[model samples]
Target chain A: MGRKRTRPDNIRLTEVAELAGVSPITASRFFRNPEALSIGKRVRVESAAKELGYVPNLAARALASQRTEVIGVLIPSFTNNVFSDLLRGIYDAFESSRYSIQLANTRYSILEEEKLLRLFLAQKPAGLIVTGIDQTPESRIIMQSVDCPIVQIMEIGPDPVDMIIGFSHADAAQAAITHLLAQGYRRIGFLGARMDPRVQRRLAGYQAAMKAASLFDSRLMVTTPLPTSVTLGGTLFADLLAKAPDTDAVFCANDDLALGVLFECQRRHIAIPKQMAIVGFNDLEFMASAVPTLTSVRTNRYEMGRNAATMVIETIEGRRPEQPIVDLGFTVIERQSSVREP
Target chain B: MGRKRTRPDNIRLTEVAELAGVSPITASRFFRNPEALSIGKRVRVESAAKELGYVPNLAARALASQRTEVIGVLIPSFTNNVFSDLLRGIYDAFESSRYSIQLANTRYSILEEEKLLRLFLAQKPAGLIVTGIDQTPESRIIMQSVDCPIVQIMEIGPDPVDMIIGFSHADAAQAAITHLLAQGYRRIGFLGARMDPRVQRRLAGYQAAMKAASLFDSRLMVTTPLPTSVTLGGTLFADLLAKAPDTDAVFCANDDLALGVLFECQRRHIAIPKQMAIVGFNDLEFMASAVPTLTSVRTNRYEMGRNAATMVIETIEGRRPEQPIVDLGFTVIERQSSVREP
Candidate 1:
């Protein structure tokens, strides 16, 4: 039956409720907060909504509830694989939920993040998931005053806007460097690109690890402000090799650099993990398939994303997580690119 | 000045009008239709709005004008690198404009796309950018009835919802296979993973090229409906090799498959281009960084995204493109992996 669809979403909640074999209030309650309803009521309501082609007027609902049926998600880059992976987890988590996602790409600019936050806050989203702890003080103030629950992802920070869920980039970096040292790479160098705040934290971890081994040398660390690419990885690694040929190993700030180092070494006929050990960050799917499978920091990016979404949604639904700040931790996957002992 | 930001957004259109040195009516008109106003008035109103950190209530605005200040984008997969590149282009194009984008990932499900389109339609978005033309017939009916302009990207078809901006995946695949044939590889095979509609089109192209060359062996074409990954490439290529031992080259459905094939070749100590050639789709940024430098179909994904966004915006602003069906076209970028001649 083709129902009379009006100017602005004419799907009646009563029709959906009748089809779902539930009360109209129950159907509406499902949209507002599915957690409040029983499982049978929730499934039946959802199925009916789908069959009847019912789409809740999020805009009208927002007006009445003073809560936009939207989630504000901020990330650094769209092209970056890391954020893409994190977003996959986020979308997966949010798909079954009623709230729509509103994404903003800050491009690693704190000012841009602040500006986007202003725009997002105006939407009065039900929940928010920000990327890191590096938002501007002005933006932080605005965020603090907001009524919605928020979760900062991808970095473990002592101070959070509301709650945070991520592994410690610094500690993860240290583990990567320590892995290299344990595998007999003493003269290890560090290569970084798009040296954002997170990269800086990773560098600090590398420094801490090297210093612990009494091999602290600033000369071996090469960095660039340019946006990162696989080719840039090669450029930075070549720069490191030229600057410090004695460097027996290198810990890359991220996978691109590590991959670049791998390619550059291959082009020049330099053996890996035997003569020059290399470690990358964020074990991208490609890293595993690369020749001499790359060793890298394996952060639970998907889990981090899922947890962040869960934290905000739960907080909004009156289910507070026991711990506001969750340090998911990281693991260093030992592969041929780093672990040579085997 | 910490203004009392509250329900209904404390920043009023009057404040924006005063800041821009214009009447409130003019400012409101600017938000409604910038094209109706002179350039000077439009700039002044926008700048004033930005300076005062004002965000127009898009929901309220949509009710009055029946045109939501947003674009509804339906994508297949967010995690896939190809879609990410396209989204990067889309985001860049929409960033400067007043319209915000609301994206929903359909996960390559036609039903999901239909559901999302229904939801998106209910929102009354100003325009819509759908990924492919493979919408369900029911969904197609709804789409045809929508008053807003629509632009479908990624795959160009004869019957677009309204407008289309993309290259033919089939034609692109044929070009790739033709390139390999020109390179004198007669025993070339095709490896496809996650055979979504686009990939299916690509496969048809492969079949077309191989049949014309009289080399179409059904045994040589290996495919999996499982989601694609770099390692999946290795697995599928190995399976292909097992079935067709004379396979001298392989045309992958996408870059991930190509990368996997390359890694498999390396693991097995097979020489690239010399012993076996390879071609990949979607010349992703990392393709060039691979050891032998993969040759792939270079599609203008970013341009497609940008063009789609531009078309939607221009339509909303009352400007129509000369053509509704745009074939942006594709190129076969010759690289080391496929170019044994040059």
Candidate 2:
């Protein structure tokens, strides 16, 4: 066979419109805003476009309308299930609303986050969704300069740049601590990974609760760098036990770390909720499946994503969301890991 | 005290250029492509832009440049550590390359994938990174219509649209079966989740290997529609035993299911390796840490993401990648779960 013949190019809007019995202007308008046309006409244009294998030149559209229908999402890491789940939720919500999400991860570094933020701004997303409120001066300035909706997720802070959709990390921490205190676990400890502002909020909340219950000095708090793995969690627990021998309960930064601590305790033959109790944040899937079922705080990770996407879409459409600060609450799931009695 | 006023509206590009003693055109050019201009002039424009907090309108720039510099990623699920790790690698590789990733999940549905593909096309990403080769007719049309680079990941196919970047699922399956067969396990069985195209590829591969070894009509293939949860895995194993009473070894779709099977076997007092041997795929984090370290196929999931990202970026830059079809090799990690030799 002769060299596989190449398909002809230059299939234009005029040809598609002609085939569909509509004007080129109508076809252009159909792509720009299909909702504006009648259903019959819209269907016809879509079919014609599909038949012709049409891909509208988005660059031309962007230049004409100055809207790309894309949003920038910057987070610390994707390996963290919490963030990944949140991203999934956002993707789902955006998909339904016909928006696309662009992602950047800073790996939990402010300097890196600053660089990513500048890059994101240069790309000109219709909106921006960042992990938390804390940002570098340069990043903050760039965010302020961008004329797009801003959303800070996973943590709450005073005076958000524009919109904030997250829970009070401090409040969740305090509630976790209070639950432990009420259970009569006086010897408590806090095991955390990373000192990102969000984690710090949880730590502050934990401290406030301990001090309020007159157990501040009695409790031990261990803070490590951000993004701790399960192995690190196991090692951190061993380290904590060596220093605080009497610790009867522990609050971990998140479930992965908590699971690690639990595994370590099991290895040491320590009876859980008998010799010690444990609680974790971000009640991920493994938490429920773990041998004893890990006790943890369940944040609405999916809802966080959905709400953030909704807020961004609404902002892009010039429809201000009624509530800028949408707090999808967290629940403390009491599993065998933290239950002291029947 | 008087109510604290919100910060004034952000400074525009004109204001920054005027303050920096340059035309708006020069300032815009400096921001659009900094590398092309003189370093001193670029620095001055950037400093002035920083001082004025001028953020470029990305939508407009994208329109003029005909490149969004964003990659669209379509994944199956983020909750799975394999996919999450892969995404993390992709995100890391793309971090400094001036390209962002837009993610969508198909929920393992071909129809949903088609919808997502159409949505991705509307946004006009610079490149596309999708999970598998399986595509609905409409999705295939959209993929073919797109004028940019397209990379199909996770599972390889015989024919790729533009580029294919992932391990061969069929090869991985055959390798696992071959390893078990070598260990003198003749009465082997295969256990898997819902039959997706990728899973089908593995199943076909397993069957081919079994037939090649003269084990056709063995009645040892067990399939389930349930997710690879621990409880589900246990139930699946129980069912498998009831149906194939003489089966000596089983290969699971993933480690999660394998772990479940292991848990059930333990509970039933069936001696591992002595009574039954098992092999799993994906080599998730918990596999190595399980009570009996799991025997699994170590697919470089993270590297898959990194490679896919690299290919997309290269395609966007008009650079031909060294190879369009990259088969990052897989290895069999022999652990206690399948080791039977004394």
Candidate 3:
């Protein structure tokens, strides 16, 4: 093969085939389905293509088929560790697949998500994996009308647009509160940040569980609209103590807040479980490795992502899932931070 | 607007224009550049398109232009907090732009990165932003030959594939050790995981710093190829202790490891800075909220990403950056974790 600097647009598959001393159809097959070609012919076509700088006209191919091998994914935030695990699962499941991922960040705004939905639909994506069931009315209408496989992830709810998979956020939050109550701790305070829809559902569950036990106190709740971070976690916990100093336990919206609460307890000489107890959502890796291993609600985020992608791909391939809605469920991991001394 | 179930492939641009009572060129302009159309025409075309369930033929447009309004991003891992900050910058920079992001995870494999490079080049992206400067030779050749502007982020080095922006990992690591040395700590060890090229540079800096002071010891190092995590940080610190129990200070490759080492020290009753000083890289938010705030190297990850993206976009728009090579640099944030009581 010669080192030729052919213009990307000018190098055709036929020229590559001629240079490789193969039929044009064989070279074309090498580009579309290399597995169908023998190894010798595959190598020859690839070398010739590389030498000639033959870039496949993906646009022309997509135009002919009226579809592109692309899966559009919409998520709220890129910095949040929760979504990171989910994204990893999605990427892992599609590693060997033909579909390329087109990711859009909604920035936790319903309007932004709606705009992105319109854009993706315009591209005629092979499939889609949306973050949650909390899209705006316009987004919902567009998604319902579109003809593509869709997977709603991060929370399970009624009236899914297509396939859906995720545990109930409210259910998980109530379970965490129940575990704390079982440990003989009342006067439980809730610390939250980034009050997104899913988090609001968690707060609702906390309220429901507390009300059931006749331990609900309006002053026990402290939340913020600001984005969540360890710093914010500590700030919210401090605010909670200022409002309800007699609080015996705290349930954080997520693990970052839980770790912050733990650090605050350590800073103030507060004893774990004795003077104060803490429970967190999303059993992030650091929770188990903290000084006092933290108790947390472990959601199957990775599994949710992997399964959602698999479902979308399978649906696109004409294999409809037996159950359109799947609840991966959650686990309450008991640890040193919340276990009381009998 | 009618809720007609018009087939996506059947609705043409001309029909949308006819319904809106506008010329076909005006309808086309509404899709390609809404800002170029007046508010009256834009709204009319949009509503008509929605009513008719019209989808823009982006593939045909891409073919005509020989480019896509897509900026391909290649990163190593999704779960790493370091890259999360970087990705947020990239996404934020392009929030209002015409280009959409096509993201691919390389899983830290050079060969995988090369494969992704070929795939992305085939799409004729408007621009590209790649993580790190450690692309395989084949990938480098492909990148160099590509027509679009490119930015190599994460770390800086000689030679420009197009443009580059990042800091020196070795210099940052050396500065971290110098600070530890100034604190009167002689036996400084290193803890690292996910020994990617950048981490290897940090290890090299640690070695250089120790050797300069005649305190280098092969026993004072623990590195792992396994992915980095808070749990792995504790495991590696435990192993380091077993190998060099007399070690007085440690420089972690990232904040996760530093946080883990802090927890392990607390578990073992080792007074931080009093018994073992700690330094971490990236200075994640948790580092500040830890009981004893941890010291860390503050790299401009967000700035790196935002600026890299801005540079690529500007280059594509025919406005070359004032400087082709950018070094954002790093700062050694002194905190309680590594500061010895005077």
lDDT of each: 0.89, 0.81, 0.92
Deviating ranges (above 4 Å) for candidate 3: A1-56, B1-56
Identify the CAPRI category of the predicted complex in candidate 1.
medium
What is candidate 2's lDDT per residue for B1-342, written digit by digit as tens?
A: 854666335466788888878788788888767787678778888899888767766565665554576688888876677888888888878877867677778888888888878767766678899988888777888899889999998877778988998888888999999998888888888888867777788888899999999985546877877656666677778888888888888888887778778767866878778788888888877666655567999999898999889888887777869778888878989888788867
Candidate 2, residue B296: Cα displacement in angstroms equals: 2.3
What level of docking quality does candidate 2 show? Answer: acceptable
Off by over 4 Å in 1: A1-54, B1-9, B14-27, B33-54
Model 3: lDDT of residue A226: 96
DockQ of each two-chain model = 0.61, 0.34, 0.69
Which candidate wins on TM-score?
1
* Decreasing DockQ order of the candidates: 3, 1, 2
The lDDT leader among the candidates is 3
In candidate 1, clashing pairs total 0
Return whichever of 1 and 3 wins on lDDT. 3
Candidate 1 is scored at a TM of: 0.91
**Model 2 score (lDDT):** 0.81
Would you list the clashing residue pairs of candidate 1?
none
Candidate 2 chain B, which ten residues in sequence have the lowest lDDT sum? B2-11
Candidate 3's docking class is: medium
Residue-wise C-alpha lDDT for candidate 1, range A206-320, written one tens digit per residue: 9998899999998899999998888989889889888998989989988888888898898988998788988899998878888889998898898888889888889988998
